[model samples]
Target: MGGLTQFGQGLILAAGLASSAVNTHAETAPIEAHAVFSPQIVSGSDALRHVAYELVLDNFYDSTGVLQLTGIDIFAAPSTKPLAHIGGSGLAAALPPGVELSADNSLSIKAGGHAVILIWLALPRDIAVPRVLSHRLEFKTQTGAVQTVDGVPVRIDTTPPIIIGPPVRGGLWFADEGPGNAQSHHWGGLIADNGQLTIPQRYAIDLFGLDAKGHAVAAPIDKLAQSRLTDWAGFDSEVLAVADGVVRDFQDGVPTHDPLAPQAPTNDLTPTSLYGNYVILEIAPNIFVHYAHLNTGSVAVKIGDRVKRGEILGHLGDTGQAGAPHLHIHLSNSVNFAGSEGLPFQIDAFNLVGRGTEGEALNAESDMHLSPGKGKPVHDAMPLNGDILEF
Candidate 1:
């Protein structure tokens, strides 16, 4: 009887093992990832086509504590090889502001907390654009086990980018803080307003004029910090309409700030205070073009006025939140600056003349010289970060 009992226990254990093995539904990891918006392939000043988007990672488990992300590998759908493998410092650098990696260089998402990763993937012009992208995330669990979540897929947006003429007239304009890195305030900007998060300046460009010698100001380098608004090279440059559109909205009467004085207080600033004197034009149905930081009283058109492309809208200046004189322009779906989403648009034509960074261009010690471009005549392409172009 005892021998029969032992055999019966063995049979029961085997049956239980079979039941577990046959179970088809099993959780892979405690974390989940999805794209905030489908990435679109857009042309930059460089030879590569850039795909810029954000991924949201959620630690949905209630009892899982903290899940640390170690690596993220992005792949074209159905491919074993990854297009980009981000790990170590690369992974840490991609985290949005206020989110820092742990001492071990792993990004931590607490239980029920979420994190965002900005992916700026550049594909060679010769390579075919992928129709879909898949991601594999490697994470270290609270229990010291390493797990991977694979096959998180997001479709690629192949829609052609919006095309328009230049917002500023002929001169060498440097695209400062343009689309490129995740560290830039504009590209990395994730605004949380009214319980909703959005990036309104994702594709916006802060344009500063460069003289023949690539200097950003009319004043001498040693005198730039103390110079007035009139001393800036881009000051009083005519801001043009990019397309035939009626004025949707605008802000006026906000006086330009004193450069030597402290910056304007950032707290409790309304849209008018943030953008200063500005204009928004309805270029298309649901597509609006925004020009910000215009000089006070420089606005030429009022709301509801229909304007033609290349029409002078206003003059650029150091107004509102602008630290210095520069034209801030972007395409959006709404007239509200912080509430709208930025759309990527290209210029009809421009001569690529040089390249330099904002730091190099703004340094007051010496003239900010730019590396000479081949003077390549570009048609319908977005000027990239640090690109110096003559429109």
Candidate 2:
């Protein structure tokens, strides 16, 4: 695991520095360090492939210290062509402790005092095709105070990754545009082989538009099955307990943010911040399901609570880091979202509507059209809603 590797390296460095600093000060001074991975192949298709790598730095001394970053980059190349530089740069204070962070081209973080710098990259569809890609990362000290075992450099590599999962789940009712017929950005599709349906809403705002007063206003969008706009006050979006599992960890009162607004205003009310309400259910060994951007004071389950499939957990809302009101769901290997790996999953029995046709099955091997009424469903596929699914 990436966390294991990061911890091991951190431990070794801490030990090495202990002896050297013993005479200077009894109190452990924070060690400032940084790590940057060289770009490696991620996926290749049509003789061309995408590459990704990470740059991570930490201050081991202060639990909260500025995390200076450098050497952030990405490159792409064809088997028969020279490596073409895509784009990258050094990040200033890009990571903070206790937040979801990843090395595999998802998100980056930097810390400054008690605040953090978050950097997110959205991949365009042209470069997101399926293929095999490799990667490598390097570590360094900001003050030039640390070096590799051979006084050279520290780095790691991994085998190329096979991009086999669809970007989003298919089949489900979705509002394609914002209020007043606002334009919608087509994110991508979610695919499953079984008779299941997963509808991933890429634009949270598009799910429901906001009025000038920040209230959720339903748009004149097509509906799948018999689903309807749930009342905000009594809203309960039929949250299937996801899986027959126990609640391993949970936190409440995180305050929901307004999705209708662009960037979160500094003076926004705390209780209404984005990621307003959330839940994480542990369905099996090292597998947890996360649901974010729920309405505040809406969670009905708590830590260690036992729940079955199709149970009401909470209502959807505009919450943390969100552009608008929508549900954010994903499965991970660890309860700590930042330190976990994303796992592909499917939901059983939901109608596929929009763009092309109504009700069809989808899988990683299928190419779906983005036109209205063109989606499908998987008959026997299991839901990835934090449940341990079997293909």
Candidate 3:
């Protein structure tokens, strides 16, 4: 797994820092891994043989469990090209698509901690095909044991959408990449309004703003409890069209609330609340883009209006189930926000600002900091957690 590495701003994981995970130590229970591939099918004739999946690894170690990840090897013994290879900037959700790795190819995991590996594999028809394809996962554990995961399978999804660049633009915005929003990993996950088996949020992410030094602030507030709608730089920021398409559906006029309100967000809602005064655009055949939490009276386009890439749509707001002023964007199989399969997408390109850490130290002046994801521009990659991007 050491060649042409493709990536996306994969889901940010809740794992220990690199140093902590690198120091390997084995405990009681072994590890458990489950791989779920999307598009559910692989067409050999297609040029873009890319397949994305989520690898769930549960560390069952009892003691001070720490597993040093030497490397992940994907092969079928004599195949010329491996089906998958890991490549990504070191960030929780930015792990290319599978495992998170430092620039030096080092990674680790804590005991009882689950490392979600994001895999985006490209298939060269010369080597593999649907169904009959046989593959193996040879992972090096910290304990010197080479774990072999056999019968790893891939489904051939006949139909899926082709994702394009980021929909909206301003200075910068950030959002959640996986599960919690897309997979309904949380209790408030988005399912279909009609009750369908969909991961509409699989490619969904939450949007926020950042400063020059990669710090986030709606607007300078007096105290933590004083967050105003205007305090959010993202508030009222213009959202754009990601593609030339027609507006299929939208809901506007939902009142936005002050994030700092003592009883802020004022309403009890769920993901089923129609993305909270949102807009859904049909950017592709059978594919729609959902832009939620929009400011009331801010929508610029209307139903059936044709929009071009970069065309202004509306401003960001704290409407619906939104607790603050930010944009909630995602791609889905259906026009509705609930129960549609999540679709992967990337910004045309953006400059890498840096990453945000779970326990990263913050400036005394604010409750946030500027760190992680600092480097070159990422092409076709989503904005992961702590990611400060400028497109």
Task: List TM-score per model, in order.
Answer: 0.86, 0.39, 0.60
Residues 84-141 of candidate 2 have per-residue lDDT tens digits of 2111212221232233333532233233332122222222346533232221122233
RMSD from true fold, candidate 2: 15.9
- Per-residue lDDT tens digits for candidate 3, residues 1-391, read 0000112223332222112122133332366765543444322111234444555566676673666443343443444334444332323342433344544455566777866555444455565444423344344555555554454444445453354666566465444333222122321232334544344566556666545554345334345346566655567888888888999887778777666443323222333374566778898887788888788888888889998888888888877665466687877678854456666665556666545431221121444444435446666555544455566
Give the candidate number with the greatest TM-score: 1
Candidate 3 or 2, higher lDDT: 3
Clashes, model 3? 33
Best by lDDT: 1
Candidate 2 lDDT trough over 10 residues, lowest sum: 1-10
**Reference-based TM-score, model 2:** 0.39
Error at 384, model 1, angstroms: 1.2
Off by over 4 Å in 1: 1-27, 218-224, 264-270, 364-374
**Which rank order by lDDT, best down to worst?**
1, 3, 2
Worst 10 residues of 1 by lDDT: 1-10
